[model samples]
Target: AGYNHDADTKAGILSACGIEAGPDDAVNLNNLDDWQEFYNAEIAS
Candidate 1:
């Protein structure tokens, strides 16, 4: 569902909902790989 939105659009949607994110931050998880990357990064942190 989120595949059609670009990074900027995703960021804008988050911003409108009061979720602030930096330019380099990922705004959506598009697939299992994306979720895995996010999970690994969080675990590392």
Candidate 2:
């Protein structure tokens, strides 16, 4: 299920739902601008 969507996609969902994300959050899937970074970090780690 987690693989079904990228982090940015999930982040978009969170944004749509008015969810407030903390700044320290490493995986900013909602942030389409940074999903690639998060994806890369996860696979590498």
Candidate 3:
């Protein structure tokens, strides 16, 4: 299984937005449920 708090994934999240991650920025993609929520929010935005 993938890591819940992978550094590579965090880096990807930062790159996705084309900006550096702030102090409050965090990626907690721990499971499919988390992915679904994040995907839905991104689509909505």
Q: What TM-score does model 3 achieve against the real structure? A: 0.36
Error of 1 at 20 (Å): 3.0
Which residue runs does candidate 2 get wrong by more than 4 Å? 1-4, 21-45
| lDDT for predicted candidate 1 compared with the true structure | 0.50
TM-score of each: 0.35, 0.34, 0.36
Which pairs clash in model 1? none
Ranking by TM-score: 3, 1, 2
Q: Write the per-residue lDDT of candidate 2 for residues 1-45, one digit (tens) a residue.
A: 233455675566556545655332434443643554565578647
Give me the displacement of residue 44 in model 2, in angstroms.
43
Query: Residues 1-45, candidate 3, lDDT per residue (tens digit)?
Result: 433445677656555554465222343433333555577699757
Clashing pairs in 2: 7-29, 8-29, 11-30
Deviation in Å, model 2, residue 31 alpha carbon: 20
Worst 10-residue lDDT window, candidate 2: 21-30
List the candidate 1 regions with Cα displacement exceeding 4 Å: 1-4, 21-45
Give the per-residue lDDT of model 1 (tens digit) for 5-45. 56776666555444565333334423333555565689746
Query: Comparing candidate 1 with candidate 3, which one achieves the higher TM-score?
Result: 3
The backbone clash count of each candidate, in order, is 0, 3, 0
Clashing pairs in 3: none
